[model samples]
Target: MKKLLAALVCSLPLVSALAVDVYDRDPDHTFAFFEFNHLGFSTQRERFDKVDATVTLDLENQVGSVEVSIDVRSISTGSSMFNQILLSDTFFDVEKFPVVTFKSTKLNFGKLDDVVSVEGELTIKGITHPLTLTVTQFKCAMHPMLRKSACGLNATGKLRRSEFNLGRFAPLISDQITLLVSMEALKR
Candidate 1:
């Protein structure tokens, strides 16, 4: 009985260590950017200014769940002309579809701490498709200034613009869009 009691006592710390932590995205640090081949020339890069996400990380199970939303109207390109173009019916059609969202279904760890494959549904322009974002660098640590537990992730993926019904200049322009993302979240 004493031996069993001691084992139970020691397991308390393990349980505490595996406690899941939920976090809210830090808008100031989270950005979803993308690059696409333009006219067989230089790659054009753009990003959404407004992004929100919630992350629930289960350290014990080595899994996580995340929901990310992006405001289509907040899309930014280097040039105002291009930005407006993207918001028009030819592209994002922000007037009709104002937002894009991703809800994670599963997280596959390459290594518990190094990389993870996040499989999810990406909805845009009224279309939902399966997508995967490979998170390459992930860390959870205490912030130096805020002193709060914070986590950051670097992930990338690619999608075919045609799949989302944004294929305006298809044959001429590239259909593949590269997604670049950086996210910082604070424990909530």
Candidate 2:
């Protein structure tokens, strides 16, 4: 009985450690920003006000997955006129499609570095396309303010707006849009 009790006590820590949840979506710390060429001369920037995501991290396998959705109507370009025009049919057409989403299918963990490459299907304006995001600096630690375990990652990718059927602006608004994603997940 004594030996059995000792073994059980030793296994408890292991079990608890294995049960630790990883990859939480911290709504306050996550943001998605995009930049695109305007008039063939200048770059225009915009950001979404509302972003939501779900993340799953497998520590034993060193793998992670994420799914994120952004409200199209929440786009902010720092100008009310431009913002309204963007929400119109010429751009995002928020009236018809309210949300844009990305669902990651695979995550390739780096052997020597903290970076991970992610491949996923991005859905926009009712069209889906496969995209690869090179994620750099993925980390997990305790948050001082939230008092919870947090995970952060940065990713960059480019997508052609025309491919998603958002070609109204065409030459006027550049087809290639650069995307930057900064996300923080908190353990639930």
Report the number of the highest-TM-score candidate: 1
In candidate 2, position 61 carries an lDDT of: 52
Output the worst ten-in-a-row residue range by lDDT, candidate 1. 108-117
- RMSD to true structure for each model, in Å: 3.4, 4.0
Model 1 lDDT tens row, 1-188 = 99999999999878866688899999999999989888888898899989999998876667789999999888888788999999999899999999999999997766555437789999999999999999878888998888999999999999999999998888678899999889999998
lDDT of 2 by residue, 77-146 (tens): 8999989998887777888999999999987787753548789999998999999988866887788888
TM-score of each: 0.89, 0.85
Query: Which segments of candidate 2 are over 4 A away from where they belong?
Result: 1-22, 112-115
* Candidate 2: C-alpha lDDT: 0.84
- In order, candidate lDDTs are 0.89, 0.84
Worst 10 residues of 2 by lDDT: 16-25
- Candidate 2: residue pairs that collide: 24-185, 24-186
The clash tally of candidate 1 reads 0
Off by over 4 Å in 1: 1-18
